[model samples]
Target: MPLGTIVRLLGKQSQMGYLDEVYNSVEDLSSDYFQTKACKAMLLKPLNAASSHCHRLKINIDDTKPREVYVCKDTSCYAHCAFSSVPDTLCKCGKVMEYAGDRPENDAKTAAAGSDNGVFVIGSQKFITTDDLQIGNVKIKVLQTRINSAVLYAEVGHDFVDLVFGLLSVPLGCVTKALSQRLSKGCIDNLYRSIAGSAEGCMGPDYKRMLLAPELAPFFGSGASQILEAAESAPKKIKVDSRFSCFKIGGFSNLGRCREQAYRYNSSYGCNRHEFTYCQNTTKTAEICELDPKLHGVQNSNCDAYVKQGPQSFMVTDDLHVRPLTLDSSLRVVSEGKVQMKDLVEKEVALTKLQIMELQRAALMTCEALSSVLLPPKKKKKNLKHLMY
Candidate 1:
């Protein structure tokens, strides 16, 4: 009996299940890809900068097989899509990138390490609390405090506040795993662990892998405050030559249909399949070289910064509420909480990937997410000379 037999017996409609999931992801692999071309145009660099920085996916098309092409000219790609390995100008498909050979023969093979987007590199610029989110030497101001035992809210930038709010965007599986199942998140941890490597027939390993460490949805992610280990995967695209192909091939048989003014068939004067062409000769398969894949409508899979709204000083409450920061709101936190002015402490800590996990767990378990993750401020030593005077 089929698995849906019980449902069928109950007089409910059901369809046969299959192992394969067939869908044309590259349905719009043409139409000039104006979106991607435009996105590339936007990622500008300084005139003094030696190398170019493009945070976009390249469409790599073989004879028919198309895949993603990852390229980073700089040795240090602090933020990148997918897994960025040693910056060697090596595209994801192992093709030596065009820039790898740009330098001298000996200097081209310089050593490079894997990307560590977890922490800010030494001496690198930090984010300033301004509307532009400018890069400068700045520190994270006091965002929260504790007077005696009660914790009070602190004013923070939109990026800083995102460290706590990003929890909602994360999937349940990632939430549980990132916290190492330390948080009390019901039985989700068990459900994630119970999935076996092999499925009887209904699914494959890819499903399991995706569930284990799912990537963020396309074009959605933390701009610079990437506390979580989530990233967007490569884009989906069609073959480069897929403007059109043979009728038998491009007529929705093995491949998808061709584009407008881009259809071809046998070239025989009276060939039965020769509907688009005017005249021709033999119907040999080698003559199949003339046709290309008719690909159109493909949009740019590139992504922009997650938060592009005009910069504003965003305030976050203990209960994870986000809003614009104002003098009244800041005063309200102090008035309502009754936290002492001198009691509030500000300390700078690296918001690395691991620390992000702690934030996620604390956000779920308690309202004081910032205070929960932040260690108690250390007491400073008294100035002996000044105090004595």
Candidate 2:
């Protein structure tokens, strides 16, 4: 088991007040304790909803597109006029809206809100002070408007009650459903699709139908086909030289000594390999290579690339095996060697190669072996015994 897992298990036991009995033989530990992150996400689910309950509505007025402030034409209601682009639409008060003018200054009596740019004036005369707008089955009334720089803001009727209900009334299941709807209809997940669809066929029909040109041929235009045909008809010769390391539209060329030869090739040849790095020819420094967004995007990066393989797949299977020592065995051998070294150093002994071999044969000897190597030889004790005889 991992050390993190052991720590988490002990934490759980302490939380349950079962620390004493946690090490019992048959503790009822759930299989969840052993599960991974993906498994936990699949199993555990939230039951109660939790939210900040803060949602604001702001109306931004475009100054450049001046003559199109939207207002309802119904003379009865004065509270529902909004600055919308859609000129012809039914207002929340069921009145037809039309383009009033550049500013809503004409209806001064309905001018409830004022800003530095202009003022917000209501269009309806009959309905003043209160008008309700239905947003997701919640009929919120317009209370008053406030100036917010270039934008105008309004507080909904019963705003406190609505916030309280948003926190208490909605369950977790409903919250999940609302989140799914928000993701799908909020123009977030499908925003890229909408943008891609809008830009379809923007490069014209001929470019869309064009095929990839052969190497050493005109990549586009009328001469592309002719150039490709000539290269096929005649045995086109391709010179391979180690001098130039990069390829370009004008054939192979050297971009001098630079690590970003690929970027230089794209800039000179008008290739879309590294779009972000193109047109940035101040100084071909290493910083430009790091700034390329293609390295972090869908395009494959030559600079930083990552490849992953499973641990089992990389395990050694041949006779060239790795043998690792256990912690206890290594510690024991190190401790013994340190003791033997300390004894020899204290005796201040020096031994010849032959005496060193003899010490090894004695299997780590005492101070006697060191004294024998260090002391001078005794003057023939056996000769003294022969003279006495």
* Candidate No. with top lDDT: 1
Estimate TM-scores for all models: 0.42, 0.12
For each candidate in turn, give its C-alpha RMSD to the true structure in angstroms: 20.6, 38.7
Error of 1 at 307 (Å): 1.9
lDDT, candidate 2, 1-389, per-residue tens: 11112223354332211211212201222222211211111111111111100001144221123123344445455432132322333344544445444322233322322222222112222312212211112222111112111101111222111121111111212222223323222233242332234335332332222211111111111111121121211111222221111111111233333333343355666765643433233433211000111111223322111111112111000110111124453344335434332222211123343443232212112222222323344455468767887
Local distance difference test, each candidate: 0.35, 0.23
lDDT of 1 at 189: 51
Candidate 2: clashing pairs of residues: 76-126, 77-124, 78-124
For residues 43-147, could you state the per-residue lDDT of candidate 1 as single tens digits? 110010101111111321111101212233232333222221112223333333221111111222111211322111212333233332211111244445544
